[model samples]
Target chain A: MSRHVIGVLVENQPGVLNRVSGLFSRRGFNIDSISVGVTERSDVSRMTLTLDGDEKVLEQLTKHLNKLPDVIKVTHLDAGCVERGLALVKVDVSSPESRSEVMQVADVFRGAVIDVSRDTVTVEVTGTEDKIQAMLDLLREHGIKEVARTGVAAMARGPKYTGTE
Target chain B: MRNGCDVVLESFDAEGVDTVFGYPGGAIINLYDTLYDADLNHVLTRHEQAAAHAADGYARATGEVGVCLSTSGPGATNLVTGIATAHMDSVPILAVTGQVPTGMIGNDAFQEADVTGITMPITKHNYLVQDADELPGVMREAFFLANTGRPGPVVVDLPKDVQTAETDVEYPSVDDVKRGIRGYSPTYGGHPRQVKRAAEAISGADRPVVYAGGGVIASGASRELRRLAEITGAPVTTTLMGLGAFDERDPLSLGMLGMHGTKAANYAVTESDLLIAVGARFDDRVTGKLDAFAPNATVIHIDVDPAEISKNVEAHVPIVGDAGDVLGELNSTLEEMAVRDGSEWREKVKRWKREYPLDYEESDDVIKPQSVVEAINQHSPEDTVIATEVGQCQMWAAQFFDYTKPRSLVSSGGLGTMGYGFPAAIGAQVGRPGATVWDVAGDGSLQMNIQELATVALNDIPVKVAILNNGYLGMVRQWQELFFGERYSSTDLDQVPDFARVAESYGVKGVTVERPSEVEDAVREALEHDGPVVLDFRVAREENVFPMVPAGAAINEILEG
Candidate 1:
């Protein structure tokens, strides 16, 4: 019943993402959030997925994920891992006071004001999920008009990725 | 200049493919015409779906990449079930579908379907050829990917125009084609440390059992598996897909395990301390009551695919390599180690075998399904390749037959697809020139793809189809009798058209064996026939495949007949 994030390095091929997600659903594993992006190796892509399940099922899921042809490696990136998420939030600012309040909150959260209009302000925030969620909750007080979120992408922490690390 | 369709024919020759199971249509007319000039042999199946199953049977029987082809739209879509069956069971096959034309691909023109889009999920890889020049590479890649690693189905969607379009590009050599898939190298040898761990587990265990599956056959590891088992003196229990991978007559054999599995096999698996699973996936059916499967075993899973190691049941020593290669290495390690006394475990399993042996009532009027299978086992050659359609017939064939050689038994283990046997038997007979191939089918299931009888007759394949005619979808009927208040719904087949008559209509020999006394004689007659023959054994309508775990029930909670 707890959320766990897993980073998977897979071949950069068409429908590899679908295979990963399809394996999840077919095995009755519940996915919370999923994100994928090109890694340093253009031939390979990294998939960060969040799922809620018991440890046994999660272990089984990892094994199933590893079974796909395009999948190269899978690692649970919860500890000693640099995890981040991005969100673009538009806040309704009818009045100048509310707009200033929104900017003040964004500044405190280290979120940049990416776009500004007469009626609304859009903020770009990126950080660990906790940071993004806390900033979004604060922005909600100013009347959130829209929100778009990318799932967490993760990698091992620090300078080394060798077996010793 | 040679057209793209001729390139397809040349590519088949380049891959050493001698036979193709396919159905021709408008989109593939050019490819069919090209076949007439080429030396490639084609077994024209009655339906596209039969072509797919036949191809699967060919793969299972010959251990070669099976090939099937169909035209656009309905023809391509018809291969969905068969393709999925091959995919789920990891049978290597190349399914070529003809597209409407490059110009009309997405236009929804006559007989146009998104062949690639539809097969994307099922295939190991798929290609919708946008250019005729890429056809050679795509075709080669399809075969390479289909047969490599955890072998499964691959699709090549050639648009009609692409087949007709002239191509000057020469066909790629096998080496060049193998190079097409750069990232698809499969590990044939396991990590040395893991192999040692597995060997140590095998030597130290008092109750060791070898759980073999189709991967053994896929890797051609049956000889290695038998040697490994003999070295450790462990009883071997094969999964349904693993039938014929080991000698069933040997004292070390525990027969098939899981739902409808032998009591001794299931008990051995449940009680064993060390379960060495070779190329077995621990499927839901095999691991009934998954949590309780091999409850006390320290599983050592050896498979070619790394992903399968701990997917279902956790393996203490997960060795990823070809089954034959892994076992070969393990055998070397075990040879240096001391053998343990397994007489206690062997004796206990022997007692179980004696206590609850697979038995059925000998009836004079109605032919027992088990008895029919036994007669087939008794009469058929040791190398006979038996293909079964789904239902009581499949379970009975798996249980009763004495499979002594690899690739001697082929059935739909994963998808449990019905109507698979006749076409599969046809394919097996074609793949293995003179070997006896039998389609052990039920009345209900045989009717699903019965049209393939024409293919058998036309090809003069000499395949023997032993239809266990129970007049019901026997497995479903068993369920209905057990749980659904005995209401015989659509399960009642009523034997319309009569399978024997249907066989005769196809210009093949057909016989109806109603009495138990006729069973052996009918089987003999079928075997003696120079061409294709069908034996419809009218079995007990109420007969059920026993030792069922009752769906979610644990393997230990099986109800023995």
Candidate 2:
């Protein structure tokens, strides 16, 4: 199965998120990750869903999503679209050497040290999923403590937009 | 300034809704008070589930949006099964529910429930109205959503405060409501290219079968379906929900198809080279063993719901549009093509029909359920509407009834909810007062909603109920006998109350028939009665519906008795 990202525009109303997520669970469609936020129009909200499925499954998923009354539009983001995810990773730095090493790794990835305690440091990273995963892999030796991630957010590369009038 | 309850009634009037089935409760008391002076007819069902089912029945019979109302919490919860049944069958129904006061909504107030959340999966759309001004618009949108493309149930939950909250907002016109819901435009016409391809597929096939379903009836496309069948000279088979979409008495008709489907219909579908599916989803019940179903047939599926096009079985040419419009296009397109002659295929289907006709053994000691069905069909008027509780009785009704028009057969097809028929028959009788309405019920299924007998007797609905009393949950017993080594379990309902006496207790006429000879006469007498009547036929206890395709087996794997 190939991984795919779908962008959906829906009415900004109560229980709209439950409607979308409930549909996926009920239909037995596995959701890898999903992110929702306000769009350019206040009345419309945008949701980015990342999932793994073959062509037919993707088509069916889109069709099912389109059937929701609150959904304004659903578009599959292809390779031309830019996708990004944000992650905040906390790592234990037992020594000064380890702190420098972690700092070096974060520097290479252009991650900001958002917080620093006596024994640990929190690094804020934002990039494509692959970049964030690579940074996390390097931080594993530093004894990762906790990580919070914002699922993939995608937008078409060109002037094309999914918006309600 | 008008209250929200006034807006609800005005919206109903604007939508041309004449009847609503519901029971008044604390949260919904204000709406009931508003209804007191309204000209609309409100059927006071014994239970909330019965009210929902009755509304569903009204929708199925009249092809309009059926409406039901209930109070908060338990009242709304009780409508779950009925709503799910309508959802599964794509029946258009609007469920209006009253919630606790807005301030106490999430504070664990008395009779409070998150009804909108509970009904999200089962409804086409729903709204928890917060402001009284939105009441008028929500009502219009709710009714529109319920009856529109791929119709299903819609819920509008109004908090008790909202019902009494006064607002100056006027009920919107139909166009205003349409403009508000911009995301719900349904495709009514099939793509021209796909229609052409479907026509080509139909014309090129050597063996073809027209498989119609409830969508045909929903779209009022029976005439178009008949035209397509005649133009192609293909035999027509229907899903249980599709009964009456094509006249069963027609020479080209192959009764019902699927689990309890006729042998000839199953055989025809298995061998056909082309399967033209119109407004019918390839449900698991209809397509037993999906990988092996219609193995050789190139499928052309026409349905209004895009999700249903290739949901189960892949369609070679999928036409996403209303059945009537798509079928109309297909017929016109086929008229231009050089169609294949299906005379040989027709003859083969006819031979199958002749060789495997539905039959049951004659018994003198007890009545045969099939004979009871035949008696009802023979005695009832041609235009009689036959509703049925789910199980062997439902299948028998579908099998034996001579349905010549759409909406003549109203049974729970998808959800298979027992106790659906009795209340549904009341709704049908209310919807079509001039036509005879019969609920052919199983003993166990009838008892599920037997309390509706009070509804019938009180309303004076002239609905005739014929009970096939087998002293067991007959369908489950059949499965147990066939698949579970006859372990019986809880299926043998030996303590079933005498249905005739039950009807009499409700102030309705009741009759009990034990002999086969009495079946027809009892049905005639019940029809001749001016009020509601229940006829209980003590059918053979172990009678099993035959030509059954065991669950998960291929359709061709028929089990004949």
TM-score of chain A of each: 0.93, 0.97
lDDT of each: 0.87, 0.93
lDDT score, candidate 1, position B117: 71
DockQ of 1: 0.30
Give residue B237's error in model 1 in angstroms: 1.3
Would you list the clashing residue pairs of candidate 2?
none
Which stretches of model 1 miss by more than 4 angstroms? A1-17, A36-84, A152-165, B166-182
CAPRI quality of model 2: high
Weakest ten-residue segment in model 1 chain B by summed lDDT: B177-186
lDDT string, candidate 1, A43-126, tens digits: 778889987788877777887776565677778876688888999999999966999999999899888999999999999989
Model 2 lDDT tens row, B1-561? 999999999888888999999988999999999999999999999999999999999999999899999999999999999999999999999999999999898999888889999999999999999999999999999988888899999999999999999999988887998788877888999999999999888889999999999999999999999999889999999999999999999999999999889899999999989999998999888999998899999999999999998989999999999999999998999998899888999999999999988888888888999998898888888779999999999999988888889999889999999999998888888989999999999999998999999999999999999999999999999999999999999999989888889899999998989888888889889989999999999999999998799999999899987
What is the DockQ score of candidate 2, to 2 decimals?
Answer: 0.84
